[model samples]
Target: MISHSSTAHPMPNSVVNLYVYDQSIAGVAKMPLDDFATAFGVPKESINLNSPELRRYFLNHIQIITEAKPWQTHIESVRVINSNDPIVREYQELLLNFICTPVKRTSTRDFTFKYDAIIHQVITHKIMVNVVQDWQGGILGSQVQVGEIALNIPKGQYFPLVVKLQNGSWWKGFGSMVSLGMYHIAEGADHLLFLLVLLLPCMLVPNGQNWGAFASASFGIKHMVKLVTAFTLGHSITLFVGAFQWIRLPQQWVEVWIALSIMISSIHAYRPLFAKKEGWIALGFGFVHGMAFASILMDIRLSAGALAWSILGFNLGIECMQILLLTVVLPLILWLSKRSEYILFRKVVSAISFLIACFWMLERIFFFKQL
Candidate 1:
């Protein structure tokens, strides 16, 4: 039976006593009480083995110590023999095993392997950490995480990564830009419809003497090129300024204005609203499109040079797609114009465009809550 030391003084607030037992050793080889006392620099009389408080403190603070020969099969169990509380025991377990472990050295020979390993680990850990945070309501609640993971990565590194992943080459950025331009044209139904409506009037003029067709088609292409160019320049300027200066506009207001611009453009198509100064209308409206484009660039958070490259890439893509569409649609427009049902088709297209624009305007302005 364990005997209590009556002469034991109360343990100091800053000091904690613990027992490290080597379980692998046979009988009598367990922690020698004299050595434990000597190692801890405490008097033999201070050890109250039977005292529950002292026993708990010891259990929570200390881990069982063991030794094994190199390459020998050994089972080493680390037991927190005493602690102030259960939390202390857990803290000791975590600190002793994980926190106190030495960091592995990175060798020059295995730099690439280690670098990839580290990257994989970081990405995996980030994903897992986010998942855990979400589970704990740390992510899904009021807090939002932001900022780049690699603050040290150079702008040069960033451009290469963007180009490598996107275009497969830095110089082939133009090809990527063209592809993006085509995608934007194909995806932008409203923009395409607006152009289509403008094409309608061109389809009505009689064959050979189709002055309206020739003029409108040529003017439409010129206007589109000018308008898109103005838009690209305007947005590129603003995108760089806004991104670097950290200028942000209310997203809702921006979206509302964009929808409004489209609605107005659609209305112009219904009648000769912008008639003689159609290019001016396109140019003016293109400014609004510029802001929309800037918002896209801003979302990307690219560096100034890369952002410039992206602007070129994106605009080129838009231009290439527009040109392709015009090429394909021009002959179709010419052929359709000669047909008896051309006017009917034109009116129908214009009406659908107008209705869609109106719907968008309403959705953007009033259905803000739904979005």
Candidate 2:
């Protein structure tokens, strides 16, 4: 007999790969074949040559594979299907049949035990919950969707279903907004640092009677508020526009300009660079910050109305956090100004800010590649 050894080898324990696509956008996930069959209510034997459902499944698989692996365009579909040999196919079929066989209704005790087991698997194991959270953030940017937006669900969707639950309310939405605000502040270290440096100068003025101190504090507060507000307004406008496909700004230029703006502000802290026209300077630089903020929204492709709400919520969150920081820091800053160490502290903080700014400027301008 002709040797078949050249064409076939002993199969591994499993052969199927299940790819889950993002409901909002067609992305792919590679999963076990047995799991895929259970998820779709398809039989492994039916996945062979003749079944229409099998053919449909194969087509979906091919579509995702084509999108993800563009270079593999020349690969034949029949060849791809047949690549899993007899032993592999048998193993996959066995696993799928075992998992998908429906159980008969049992006693309440059995049901409770099973329910507890499922909860343990879901909550303690946590793989399912984490995957779902990541998928939701990819779509919603942590916003809680309600009403008709929640009804348009797709098959194999991975987002948290809680947002659509009857118990889900505005409190959840507010909490989500708060979480996103803190996340943005933590993630945008450069922005936070620039704001801190801006506050450093105010720390040097005398607390009560010093007219220069009073003037500087008043100016700083007004300038910071105007700058932040302008940034919020600019970004909100662009975010909606970009998300809805109205306009597209060059992202690379946006990032570079954002870094440059921070650098410029840091330099200004060293000496009064925009002393008289601080508001104008803030407005000009705030435009760049707006672009930076817009970049985040563009990454989240939501429906037009959803995008608008997200932009509003995100900006409101940012403003609230900024206000909170000011409330806590302003009193301490006013008190510190009257101290003997105030001038030294300002110089040291300003020097550090200037150094960081120079580093960022060089990194952005020359494409330093490594920070």
Candidate 3:
């Protein structure tokens, strides 16, 4: 299989990934003691994987053309990787990475790809071509089929594939990031749990140590708004700094802290540990949660201009989702606060949240120790 992709600040060149089964390449085999072993008409040991002849062979067989001119191609590296598929279980494949550059600066979206590789000698072999990532095309983290390359049995020749990818714009990329952010929060249980636990007692007044009667609707709404804004502000600061790599912490520790934050909030919800100062506590925990959010942006690896847009879109999505959730749940919580049994209901929810957080904390610690 051959994959065409691009990343941040993509140059006027193309990156390709070529996957070939070991059995298709003669003399090269997967052995028990070696990742890639060579057999010259008989069983033998390893050979130089970085041989010039091997590189030349691949470069000669593959071609990427735009207009009437051919691009300069280089074999970056060849790696042996094991397969876990049921059909080819325990088998190994060779990954040949290639970088092709045009003689003159031009767009790489449209090109004619001609690859033979092992299929030149192995008649039954086939090669699949796909576009795995085109950042500008809004094709991040996905695979789209370009075409396949195989011998035309009757004609005894291989057909060249012409690939034309869809055009993309900045809005498309930004919109995708927004959707990703909304999905992340909607799917993240820990983030939702912490927010919900913190908001549990916002509608009630503090009576020295315990939660008192339900406050006026206006007061409750105002307090909730202040608390949510503080949390949002705290995270937004770290999300920006951490995305640019200005501040970073070990992911394991961040995860452990996130779980711990939920546990602490659960305690505060049940007994009003922080009482009227919940907004301050929310701000502190929000900073920790922002670090976790930063890991996502770091993995995206976008360029400066695109990264800025993404950060804005992503944070907007998170806030929108949080507002939506609060809108749906706020009325119910307010009504329950006036009931005589709301204290019991609140304690039950807090206990469950605390136990769930304890489990997550222990799991994250175990993962950290293993690393």
Highest lDDT model number: 3
In order, what lDDT does every prediction score? 0.41, 0.45, 0.72
Better model by TM-score, 1 or 2?
2
Over the stretch 77-128, how does candidate 2's per-residue lDDT look in tens digits? 3211222444455333222100111122211111000101111112211111
**RMSD of each candidate?**
22.0, 14.8, 8.3
Give the runs in model 3 whose Cα sits over 4 Å from its true position: 1-83, 89-108, 111-127, 149-162, 368-371
Name the lDDT value of residue 179 in candidate 1: 57
Model 3 whole-model lDDT (C-alpha atoms): 0.72
Clashing pairs in 3: none
Error of 2 at 24 (Å): 3.7
User: 1-371 in candidate 1: lDDT tens per residue?
Assistant: 11123513232111111110111110001222333444444565575555554434333322222121111111122223333332222211111111111123211110100011112222221100001011111111112222112213345221101100111233443444445546656886755765555444533333332223334556545554555455445545554555454576765676666666666655555455655555565555555555555565454333366456666776666656666777888778666756667656665766777788778778777876521
Q: Which of the two, 1 or 3, has more lDDT?
A: 3
Candidates 2 and 3: which is better by TM-score? 3
State the lDDT of candidate 3 residue by residue for 1-371, as single tens digits. Answer: 32224312111112233221111101111122121232111122344458786677767877778898887877767666554433324655565666666778777667777676655655555566766555556655555666667678899887877877677667877787777778879998999999999889899898877888899899988988988999998888888988888998988998999999999999988887888788888898889888888888776656678788888988988998899989977998889888999999999999999999999999998855521
Q: CA shift at 40, candidate 2, in angstroms?
A: 22
Which window of 10 residues has the lowest lDDT sum in candidate 1?
A: 126-135
Compute the lDDT of residue 5 as modeled in candidate 3.
40
Rank by TM-score, highest first. Answer: 3, 2, 1
- C-alpha RMSD (angstroms) for model 1: 22.0
